[model samples]
Target chain A: MKLRIYALAYLLFLYAPIILLPLFAFNDATIIAFPLAGFTTEWFSELTQNKALHEAVKNSLFIALMTAIFSTLLGICAARAGAMANFPGKRGIIGFVMLPLVLPEIIVAVSLLVILRQVLGVNLSNWTIIAAHVLICTPFCIAILNGAFQNLDPSMEEAALDLGESRWSAFRLVTLPLVMPGIISSMLIAFTISLDEFIIAFFLTGTNPTMPVYIWGLLRFPASLPVVMALGTLLVALSIILLTLAEILRRRGIKRAGGTDKGGFL
Target chain B: MGLLSAPFTYAILLLAVPLLAIVLFSFWTQDFMDVNTTFTMDNYREIAEKPIYFSLLQRSLYVSICVTIVTVVLAFPVAYFVSFKVHPSRKSLWLFLITIPFWTSYLIRVFLWKVILGYNGVINSGLINLGIIEEPLTFILYNVNAVIITLAHAFAPFAILPIFVALEKIDRSLLEASQDLGESKLMTFLRVTLPLSMPGLVAAVLIVFIPTIGDYVTPELMGGAGGKLIANMIQVQFLQLNNAPLGAAIAIVAMLSVTAISLLFVFLNRRWLRGRS
Candidate 1:
C-alpha cells in the first residue's frame, strides 16, 4: 500500500545515518566510500588500543554521570517547588528556567565560555563542561520531572503528613517512590544530552575532548574515517539504548500513575 | 528552607550570573590588556555598517525558512499517516523511529552527509560511474545547498514530532462527520485537518526556525564561504577576532530578529486559529 511505503521512507529518513554508521565502521578500508574493501574487525579493534580515545571516553563518561545526577537532583527540587509550594513569581521563575531550551545554544555556549574564561578566570577542564551541561540539562530534567510531579496525588502527601511524618519524610516515602521512574528517565535523558552535545564541549574543553568533539577533530583527517565511524557506531548504539530505556521508564511511570500529559520529551 | 535554598542558590549563582554577565559583556569594549568598562555603541554600529552582515543574516533566515517549509510539507503527510492511518499500537513505534536520530551525536549525522556528498564520496562516485557528470561536483559538499540539506536532515524530526502531537489531539469523530457530510478526502484534510493542526505547525516552525538560524556547526562544516551565516560571524568576533562586544552585538541582533520572526508567525497563526474557532 502507499501508506506502507510512506511509513517505510519516513523511518528510513530518520534512521539511515544510524544504520550507515556501523556498516562502514565494519568495512575494512579506511576510505568511507561505497564498495566496501572487505569485511574486517580492525576498526573496532583499533578503538580498544587508542589510549587518547579511551581517556576521552572516560572523561566524557565521568562528566555525563555527574551532569545527570546533579541536574536530576536540581530538577527534583525545582519541580517539587513549582508543583507543591505556593511561591511568588512562580510562572516567571519557570519561564526563566526554561529559557535555555529556546535560547540559541551557540549563544549559551559563547556566553558560558566568556564567563568561565574571561570573567571568572577559571581553568577549563571536565568541570567546565559539566557546569555547561548542567545549565542546559537541568531545564530538560525539570520539564520532564514537572510532568511526574503534576501527575501525583497531593492527597497522598497530605495523608502521610497526618500520620506523623515530616514534609521531607512524606516526600521521600510517598511522593519519591511514585516519581522514581520519572526521575530515572530524567537522568537517562540528561546523560544522553550531555554525552552527545558538541558546541559547549568544543568551547569549554581545554585538553580533554568529549566524544563528539573528538569526532569533529577526526573529520579533518581523511584516514580517520573508519575510526570515526567505529566510534559513531558505538555512540549510536549507546544513545539508542539510553533513549529506549528512558521511554520505557516514562511509559511505566505513566501506566503506574494511570495518567497522561503533554511534554514528555523536550 | 536552607536545604531548598541550595539548588536555587546554585542555579542562580552558576546559571543566572553567567547569563547576565553575557549581556553586560556585550556593552564593554575590548582593550589590548583586557576588556574595558566603558559602554559604547561601536559594536552595534559596526554590525550595522557591514552589508555582508545583513546579507549573511538574510541568507541564514532564508535557509531556515526554506528548511521549515520543506519539513512542514514533508512532515504533514507522515504525521497524518502516523496519527490517523496507523493503528494506535503502531503509533509509538513510528514516534520512536522518528526520534531515535536525536539520541545520536549531531556531529556524526553531519559527518555522514560529508561522506554522502563528498567529491569522491558515495553519491558523487555513483554519479561519476554512471557518467552523469564528467567531473565530481564540489557544490554538493561545501555550499549553501549542503548546509540546507544537512540542517533539514537534522531538524526534520523536530518538525515532525510537534505536528504529530497536534494531529493526535484531534477528535476522530470530526473527520467521520466530514465524511458523513460527503466531503472528499483532500477537501476534508484542507477544511478540517489542516486548520486543527495550525498550533503544531507554528510550533514546528519555532522548533526548526529558531535553532537553524543560530546554528554555527552546519554552516561551518557544510557551508564554505557560500554558507557562512551570522552565527559564524558572531563566532569569529568572539573567538578568533577577540571582539566580544561586536560578537555580542551581532548575537543580540540575531536573537532579536529570530524573536521577531517567531512572534510574527505566532501572531498570524493565532489570528488564523481564532478565525477558525
Candidate 2:
C-alpha cells in the first residue's frame, strides 16, 4: 500500500502538467482555470492563422529535417569509427564526442554565441542553429548507431568481400542495408532533439524564430496561454509519435542484426 | 566513399572548429578591436572576487543536491514497481507512461508549474475552496521551493530510468536466497536488493545532479528572485552584462566545481565499494 502510493505520487508528479496541456488547449476560455469553461478547438485553429507562428513552425521543421540528415550521416561515420575502427586516440575521440553530453547547455550556447559572433565576425542566423544542433545531435546519433553497428557481425562484410565483392560494394550492399533501421531511428531522434532545443536556438536564430523560441516569446502574453498550450500539445503528440516509431525501427534492426532482446539507449 | 568523406570532413570543420576556438579564447584575453596575445589569469580571479558568484554557485550546487535526493527518494518506488511488481508484458506500458512527460516541450511543462503554483492557480484554489486558508499562498510560486519542485519533476524520469535498469539487472534468486535464509522482507530488500541497486542510484544521482546544477530555465521562471542560480549569473554576464570573459570565467569555475564534486563522489563510492567488498 505504501509502495503503491509512492509510485502513484511519483508518476502523477511526472505527468500531470503534460496531460493538462492538451486539456487546456481544448478549453474555450482564454484563462486557464478549474471547471475549464467548456471545450473548444479555437486555439488549435488559431495556430494555423498566425503568420509568425506558422513561419516559426516552418523554420523549426526545416532546421530539424536538415539537422537530422547531417547528424545521421555523421553518425554513420562516427559510429563506424567508434564501433569497428581500431585507430589511435579512439578513447580520446570517444570522450571528445561525449563532452557535450555533460557540459552545460548554457555554456555551450554562450561559447557558440561568442565565437560565432565575435571571433568569426559571422552573422547569427538559422544556419547557426543548424550548426549548433548538428554538434549536439551527432553524439546522440553516434550513441544510437553504435548500438546498431555493434549488433552487426562484421564477418558478413568479410564474407561478402571474399565472395567476389569489393569493400565499398560489400559495405553498401551488406552493412548499409543491415543497419538502415537504426539509421532511420537516429534520424528521427536527431530531428526531435533539434526541434525541442531552445537555448541554442534562442541565441543563434536570427529574425526567424524556431518553434520553442517563438513559444518563449509568446509566453510573455498571458492571453496566449491556450494557443501556446495547443502548440505544445501538437509538439508533444508529434515527438511521441516520432520516438515510438524510432523505438520500433531500432528493435527491428536489433532483431535483424541477431542481437539479444534488449540493449539500446532510451 | 565520397559521400562518407564529405560528411566526416563537415563534422570536423563545423563542430570541432568552433569548440576548439572557445577553448582557445578561454585561454587568451581580449581588448579593444583586437584580442591580446597575452594570456592571463585575470578572468579566473574576478570569479573569486565577486561575492555573488560564489553564493549563486553554492545555491546551484545545493539545489542540484536537493533535487537529486528528492528524485531518488521519489523514483525508487516507481522503478521498483515497474522492475519487480509488474508483469513482463506490462513493463513496456509502464515505461512508456514514464516517458510521456518527456514527449512534450520541457518549457511547457515548467511553465505549467508556474500556473499550478501561482497565487490563484490549482493548489491555492483547491486550498481556498476547502477553506483551509482565507487567502491564496504567495510563497509557493516564486522561490527556491518552486525551482526545486519544477526541477524535481523534470528529472524524475531520469532518476527512474536508470534505477529501473539497475533493478531489472538484479537476480531474483538472490532475493529468494535471502528470504530462504530466514530474513524478513525488509531485511532481504535492504541486504540483497539495496546493495545491488547502488549502480543505478549512482547513475540516477549523476543524471539528476549534473543537469540540475547547469539548468537555467526553471530557476529563471520559478526562482523569481530567491531562486537565482549560477546559470542566471552566467547569463547576465554573457548577455545583459556583456562580459564574455567574466562569463567564461564563471562558466569555467562552475564546470570545475561540478567536476571536483563529481570526482569526490566517485572516489567516495569507490571507497564504499571497497569496504563492502
Model 1 chain B: lowest-lDDT 10 consecutive positions: B1-10
**lDDT of candidate 2 over B1-277, digit per residue (tens):** 3333544556456556755666566665657455665678777776778788888999899888888899889888899998888778667668867875764698898999988998878899999999999999988889988999899998887788889989999999999998998999999988889889999988888777876777788898899988899988887876676667767777777877887888899789879877987
Model 2 chain B: lowest-lDDT 10 consecutive positions: B1-10
* Candidates 1 onward: DockQ, in order: 0.53, 0.46
Residue range A1-266, candidate 2, lDDT tens digits: 77767777778878788878888999989887776788799998998899998899899999999999988988888778666756666666666765666566776787788778878889978888998888788878887787788878889999999999998999999999989999998999899989999877877888888999999888879899899999989898998899889878877777788775343355
Positional deviation of residue A154's Cα in model 1 after best superposition, in angstroms: 2.4
TM-score of chain B of 2: 0.91
C-alpha DockQ for predicted model 2: 0.46
Candidate 1 lDDT tens digits, A3-100: 77886897777776777788898898878878777788898888899998888888889999999999899888888877766666666767676667
Cα error, residue B20 of model 1, in Å, equals 3.3
Best by TM-score: 1
